[model samples]
Target: MKGIKFDGNHSYDAYQLFLNSYSIGEAEPNTNLVEIPGVDGAVDFTEYFGGVTYKSRILKMQFTFIADRFGLNAAYAKLQNALNGRRVKIVLDDDREYFYTGRVSVGALSPDGQIGEVTLTATCDPYKYKTKVRTATCYGHTVGKGVGTVDSPTVTLIHASVTNTGGAPAVPTFNGDKAFYVTATERHAGGSSDTFLNESESLPSGKDTAISGVEIPAGATQEFGFCCVGEGDLTVTIKLQERSL
Candidate 1:
């Protein structure tokens, strides 16, 4: 047996690359060898359909578990919160969604008792995005005139007792004349007041039309062809913005 010399001073030729039990930078030399490592993770998803284009958001999470005598291989993340990490969902409701899951990644393992970052990621396809447009159409409106000219027309809202019986946001809004729903105030002023007359529920600020609302949800839609008494041309436009989880 050739005597492999153990020189107290690590030899650059071999000691430089020698495997050790613990990380090298310990305040005091720790003989611990079974320490596991560090960790990291990520997820991606895309969505197409329901009138929405594409939106993405990352739900970041941290994994800080040092391996005990057992080993880092035993480290585990339930990922119940977010499997493929969280992305933005347009639907404003409490939902426990099932995300994606990929292979596990360990932290950068240190040779000399150093720790490694274990990273795992779950990627998905456009989870959800949409334009929630809250509105109702009253066809036979008398077609209010310059009322669309930011002139707060004296005409009252079409449906005095009108109620949108749906889910979640039940009472869309019917304040004043016609403000059950919420939108930008510009639509009222900048809109074509010649004859094409219509009003949307004002946003939280009491402004109508200027801003757009989300697309209608996936469910039974309330249909109304005309408002007989004073019929007018009604049009609806929905605008959407990207959001995070």
Candidate 2:
């Protein structure tokens, strides 16, 4: 686990002196599987009855630490700071990374006066822990000029938004094989879009505002294109991450 690393505003091994046992919580699906009322016993109706979503519950975790008065105090301080509500990333056994982004509450503290060791328990809010993250960038393109592309390296859910600080209306195209577009009616206002694709997607100047989802296969490069619809410049930002299968 030499490559194993972590940072919760600090290094993971920084607490090695006090660190005892660490374990990750189980992962649950972020979707609802509903059953159809009139289905026959031979067929599973629930599989076709409801909508599935991408939101996950908090990722529960536990860590045990053994330390003395000074070590205990230092460990407490580090965990205390993490409780301020920022996410803490942990690289589990050099496998993958997970974050404690919600709540991190400390359990009861136990002290061994004679041995000078303290035991502590910590809990994290539920979350479908995230894996590695990657980024892609797209430059602004004027309306009717050409399309812009944003690429990704894995099967990912692309979260993207574009801000037009300039004084003009614009339309962005999201294209892979099929095309999706977003339109802005006024100037200086910002608009954003999200899509998942394996190959590529483009944004063109148009008046349609409907958005859709796309699939980005693993190791595939996805692209996003844009064009000015009115009179100002556009700035596009895109984020990509692999989704739990």
Identify the leading candidate in terms of lDDT: 2
Tens digits of per-residue lDDT, candidate 2, 29-92, equal 3544455678654443433554333333333333444455567667756655644344445444
- For residue 21, give model 2's deviation from the true position in Å: 2.9
How large is the C-alpha RMSD of every model relative to the true structure?
22.3, 12.6
lDDT of 1 by residue, 159-185 (tens): 221222322222122222322232222
Residue 178 of candidate 1: its Cα lDDT?
A: 28
Highest TM-score: which candidate? 2
Question: What is the lDDT, from 0 to 100, of the residue 216 in candidate 2?
Answer: 40
Clashes of each: 59, 29
lDDT of each: 0.27, 0.37
